[model samples]
Target: MVAYRSKVVERIELPARERRERALEEAGYNVFELPSEDVYIDLLTDSGTGAMSDAQWAALMRGDESYAGSRSFDELESAVAEVMGFSRVVPTHQGRGAENVLYGALLSDGDVVPNNTHFDTTRAHVANQGADPVDCPVAGARDPTADGEFKGNFSLERAREVVDDVGAERVPLVIQTITNNSAAGQPVSVENTRQVREFADRIDATFVIDACRFAENAAFVRRREDEFADYAIDEIAREQLRHADAVVMSGKKDGLANAGGFVATDDADLFERCKQRAILYEGFPTYGGMSGRDVAAMAVGLREAVEEGYVTDRLEEIQAFADLLEDAGVPVYTPPGGHAVYLDAGAALPHLDAADFPGQALVCELYREGGVRGVELGSFAFPDTDRPELVRLAVPRRTYHGEHFEHVADTAAAVLEKRESVSGLEVVSEPANPELRHFTAALAPLSD
Candidate 1:
């Protein structure tokens, strides 16, 4: 129902996204491949967040190892302790699975779950528990990296005020780290983490972290903060872990393995319950439904992910791409800082009416010309049918380097030039539900 203007720089005079659509269809293997195999720079997701080291891969695939039965739990446990320093450690199949168990256990139907902001899965978990998640946009925090750190952060003061009003016991406070993907991977500094954690303690509230991106977050902290700048990645990670009572992680991101997730906590009672639930959904507590290979990879990847110049390089790559877009006169999100450039289609396509899919048009154009795939922010990523559309270009961490960026920049210019020829989103099928989308890639001609 409402929309904003997009600041897309003009480039090509007749955007021909339809051609690219044909190309993609011709390829026909793009089935939203599993996160591990997909190279979607994932600025939009912490999926494929971490990758395993050679050593971890070696350990995971050792033929001498029992794929079905291994003392992997010991390895997993030790790794969790070393990384999270939690009093208790439990495993799960993946991040969202852990969230389901965590929120399912903690929240009753009537209870309220509070967080600076909720990741998609975490939010869904709480909602499924028949509880509503209350947003506490902590500490005047408006993307400290508005600028783009790719480490997750939220406002601390907002956290405090929300806890105060909710009376801690009624609403729990959650602090997550690394690639606060929702806010463009902004880093939540150690000091801020401490502040928010302390505030939760002040009110006798529970604090949980959605710590899938811990590795990336730690790397950023080490690079930026004076105190942490000196600490090694491992030490910085430990520091962040000490602040949260519990954290749910998608091992995919931090562990860099193919699949695995865990819940780490100091609360004995709570930890036990979660572990039991995990077994029901996942596997034994020891493996948490993971193979020894994955556990090994996660162990190694966790280490490498924080290694000097690892995460920073990926972030810088994203920044460079954004810089080119900016130089090209395309209005990218202010101060490209993370792993991808988020196109403010609201600002880019102000003329797009509700019936128009401005973001889709941009995405289609980008894809058609450049063989690039970006997410449709409005209806796809954060689908609010009534809200304006936006497009998110996630530069997959390792898929492309400078060359890809240059192509993207030139392609963006081309799209801008043919902005009027850009088409609107055409829906093919609404089917039975709001979540279901079945549409052929069709666009409306941009209105003159």
Candidate 2:
């Protein structure tokens, strides 16, 4: 095992209880709306929240800035081709930008897209294009206590039903989100990916991998899938991508970068259409929506993200964090997941119903109790849907340490102790766009 240390540190002081209370009230009870200064530990997301490595920083310094054909773009393209095994690459500002560009090119009104489970933004982007996003995660995913190694696997049966209902023509894209975020960040198995690929081919739909956390997913495959037990993480990752016709990735997550994303594909027709969409929605095909330096840093981060030692350590750390929560009597998703430890908010606060926003209530309590901010992935995020009430503590890559998670565990335990006291929230104000309302929605305590 390789030892790692923080060569740099930034001091952060926990906000006072009263200040947190005021901040929460001022932000209308939305954790995402709170200022960073009030948050001691921010687990709102892992996207663009990681610390850059020395190599990434060096790459940034040497980045070439040009309007049309920058060397930085070439480097990023080469890295994506090598790591993801795609012949073409298109950079974007972030994961959602990649989603927007790709979906814009493929989706049509009344079309259907299926995945293991679509994350918040993915679902929103699909809806924005007047397309429906269907989730087909295995049944085990809904049961937080189910100790399955690959709960993230897409259900081929469920997908078949969708295809039959919509007709294969209306189903344009079939995606698998590796390390499925919406399903407690669980990892997809290689067998499942191959089967999904076959299913897609049968339906004449394109197979796409929502590969934001592909490296972490590959690590899980190496451990759980018997066939790939001896495979290195990168080798397993390549195999996973090999099953896909195209890939959309958030370089921020597994790439270990602050910001950047890409769409890669072997299909020339789809690649050309995606590039045109990128030119309109993002930027020129070369730079897309990223700065030259960000593109360069992403190139280095992508390679670093798959190093055997680094990927293994990342999984071990997340598992250790989950162990801490379980030891504290906190209800967490079993077997842990690649990036986050999801709290079963419904189990913790059984008194609160789905309409009461149990997950958001838990998020509020955590921030007020310990200045720790976590995001809700339940009714609040997917309103009117039968999703699990989960509060996700997404640890940023190479950011917080064990002490931080220890504090989170203790805080969560405290919240569970006073679970009955926690009140559900009613939306006071929200954006007109219901798909992305959770980000800016205002809420007040539910009336007794």
Best by TM-score: 2
Off by over 4 Å in 1: 1-46, 49-52, 63-69, 138-152, 160-167, 353-357, 383-390, 426-448
Evaluated against the true structure, the overall lDDT of model 1 is 0.62
Model 2 C-alpha lDDT per residue in residues 121-172, reported as the tens digit of each score: 8999999999999999998899998878899999999999998898999998
Clashing pairs in 2: none
lDDT of 1 by residue, 1-448 (tens): 1111223322223224564455444433221321322222223343653334457667777522353445666676777787667757777778878887787778776667666556456666776777666555543233322443423456765665665675667665465545565554456778878877877777776778788777667777877788877788778888987888889888877676678888889899998889788878887776777766676666666666666666667667667778898888776665443445777665565666646667766775666666556666455433453323555676544444465578778877887877766656555434332222312232334345
Query: Per-prediction count of colliding residue pairs?
Result: 44, 0
Please give the TM-score that candidate 1 achieves against the real structure: 0.80
Prediction RMSDs, each to the true structure: 7.8, 1.0
lDDT of 2 at 285: 86
